[model samples]
Target: MRRADEPDDRRTLERRALTEWPEQAGAQVRSVAVAGDRAEVTLTVNGHHDYWVYYRRGRVGREERVSGNGPTLGWEDPSAIGW
Candidate 1:
């Protein structure tokens, strides 16, 4: 059976991003880029840009939110995160 953590495609990656980061559940998915087993998701919520990166193992390796309160989830370095 396919587990929720193992996102293998674009749709699954998007869903996993929301499930793993519930804070961005209502956020709009601005973009989703999949390469092999990895994926990078961009979301916008409350006028701020957020990022969610799914690694080769289908797990979310990094996440970052840019909101009024600042980074709330993961690494702050933009160079360290993303696709």
Candidate 2:
């Protein structure tokens, strides 16, 4: 389980890498949020609209996947999420 307030740099890096998988070619990660073993990443695949991605630790760091994908999220601006 992951704590909301506390953060794990390793987990974030792992999740970020997972987000960049070949299947997501042309997509760009804009933001990342980790809560426990679950992760949510915002991206712009088409370079226009935004998308939200969901991932969870599979078998304790054995794998990661994009479980959910949809329209832009209801949060801060997309550009503010990352570079």
Candidate 3:
């Protein structure tokens, strides 16, 4: 079984960025999780106070902020996240 905190495989990250999270270009993901086919992510940007839900891929996907809020979700190429 795979855990959410486990480092995402390069291919998984690439696929998610290209297909699932193309809209989250400039944001940085603080954490990511995958259960079965679903994915959940936590992200924050330079100007934002709170982290936001970045993306969820698969059934029952969801994104939510864990802290303060400021900036809206923005898109950046996955390469920028230093995957």
RMSD of 2: 9.0
Question: Can you write out model 3's per-residue Cα lDDT over 1-83, one digit (the tens) per residue?
Answer: 14465454423543443343345455566655554433444455543633433333334433322223433322222333311
Count steric clashes of candidate 1.
0
Model 2, 3-45: lDDT tens digits are: 3343575456435654555663666667666655555666666
Candidate 1, 22-41: lDDT as tens digits: 56346666666544433456
Better of 1 and 2 by lDDT: 2
TM-score of each: 0.45, 0.46, 0.35
Candidate 3 has which clashing residue pairs, if any?
Answer: 23-75, 24-76, 25-75, 25-76, 26-75, 26-76
TM-score of 3: 0.35
Model 3 / residue 21 / CA error / Å: 8.9
Question: Which is the leading candidate under TM-score?
Answer: 2
lDDT of 3: 0.41
By TM-score rank, best first, the candidates go 2, 1, 3
